[model samples]
Target: MADLLDQKVQAQSLVDVVAERLEAAIISGTLEPGSRLSEQALAASLGVSRGPLREAIRRLEGRKLLERTPNIGVRVAALSLRDLKEILEVREALEGMACALAAQNMSDEDIAALEGLIEAHGEQEAVREGKGYYQESKDFDFHFRIVTGAGNQRLEQMLLGDLYYLLRVYRYKSSTKPGRAKEALVEHQNIVAAIRNRDAGAAEGAMRVHLRNARRYVEEQLVEEGEAVVDPAPRKTGRVGSLR
Candidate 1:
């Protein structure tokens, strides 16, 4: 019984490590979207057995990060321009509300930690060079912190669990636009300042503005690449107006 439990633990740990490694590669653009994945090659490259690698692939597949087709094997999932726009629209609404809730719910220590994250991002080499933003994963991102600070389990599952990696893929691409990293850093500061002041309306407004700008940037990039045409107009919505 003890050996069986140990074996189960070891197998799960191996799966976890393999999943994380593959996720990192996908997020880093090392594994391009829609590119076919060679399981044998992946297993060899990662120095893992086929069993664990296949389990990792299954987990990512369930996350919608990978796609499997009959007789065609597995490939990384690619988001079309329309798909990206739709996701961004939903994210703008959801994360804006999250920022508002975070402003009301987060303690002083949480707010301070959020500010420190921004500070650390500002000092990153890629950010300083105007090359890219600093978010490598949910753990290190400013928006992720605010969403977690909202203290809503359902919201956390939706944003952090469901949409996080998909958004990270496009967010990294959007942040590569010239001067976008610095602009986004300033936006992060504005968000943090509003949260620190406990101004829920202002926090929500700042978050919406930031995400809307990101949507515009992504649209522009897609247009430039001749991938898709996106409507550039911002949708009008009712204001939160002083949620103190």
Candidate 2:
């Protein structure tokens, strides 16, 4: 009985590991949205058996990161403009709460660490030489720190687990907008200052404003390009540890 239970546990662990690896690939844009997920090819590439690979794909489907059709197998989830805007709106509510809690609860050491993250963003070639943009990793780090600092288990899981991968997909898609990247650094600075002062209300307000501005910028860009923005499907609405 014990041996049988252990084997089952190990199998589940493999599935979880496989799911996480595939999730990271999808999030990082290595698996582009709408790309087909070939089961035999993926199983062979990852050196895993077909059983575990299929289980992992099912896990992603539960997370809404993969969609399966009767004829098409599975594909990475694609977001439309409305999808992006709705994501930002949900982020505003959740992250604003996180910023407020972080201001009140974070240790002095954590706050300093966040400031260091901002300084690193400022030193990037784009921000420094006025020729490039802040790297997405640095941008994600700043927000991840604050959310983790909030010290809420469920909140951390919701943001990091559910929304984060999708967030990365959209960020990469919209990163080409002129001038927004530089402006984002300045907004981040304001958010950091508010947290440094331990001003919960100000921290929350600043975080919301920054994200809302991002949403507005994307909407405007869509209009300019004449892309039809669809309405976001309502979904019921995270950060800790080294994301890298």
Candidate 3:
């Protein structure tokens, strides 16, 4: 019984390591969207057995980062422009609410730490040179801290789980748009300021505006690239819509 448990633990650990590496490659664009995966090649590249690689692939499929067809093998998931636009819509609402809660719930020290993170990002060479914003991890770190500070377990899970990983796949491309990095940094500063003041309303409003702008930027990109066709109907405004 003891030996069986040890073997199970070892297998799980190997799966985790393999999953993490695959996820990193996908998020970094090292594995392009819609690229086919060859199990034999991947197993050889990672120096892992087929069993563990298969398990890792299954996990990514559950996360919507990989897809399997009936006859065609597994491939990296490619999100449509409409899918990305819808995600931004959901994030604008949920993250705005999260910022409001963080303003009320986060400790002063936590807010200060967030400020320090933003300062560090400002000092990065890419940001200083106006070449790009924070790298994937750094950008996610800023949002992750705020989401965790909201003190809502379900909300944290929703934002920081699979959805977060999906967004990371495109976040690098989005941050590289002309002048967007600088604009995003200023928006982050505004959000921090509102949270520091413990003004929930202001924090929420600032977050909504920031995300709205980001959504618009993405829409423009999609239009320019002809990835999505815009509707001629007037846009509606009200409470944020549901992801469902």
Cand. 3 Cα-lDDT: 0.74
- Model 1, position 95, has a per-residue lDDT of 96
Tell me the TM-score of each prediction against the true structure.
0.81, 0.66, 0.74
lDDT of 3 by residue, 1-244 (tens): 1111112223448988788777767765557566677787677566668898899999999987888876667777766777788888999899999999999999999999999998988987777776666444533478888999999998987888777876776665456578887888899999999999999999999989888877787577656755453442222322111101
When summed lDDT is taken over every stretch of 10 residues in candidate 3, the lowest stretch is 235-244
Which pairs of residues collide in candidate 2? 126-132, 156-238
lDDT of model 1 at position 207: 96
lDDT of each: 0.77, 0.70, 0.74
Worst 10 residues of 2 by lDDT: 235-244
lDDT of 2 by residue, 124-235 (tens): 7656654334244323467778889999988898787766756765554344367777777888899989988999999999999888877786677667865423533221
How would the candidate models be sorted by lDDT, starting from the highest? 1, 3, 2
TM-score of 1: 0.81
Q: Return whichever of 2 and 3 wins on TM-score.
A: 3
Ranking by TM-score: 1, 3, 2
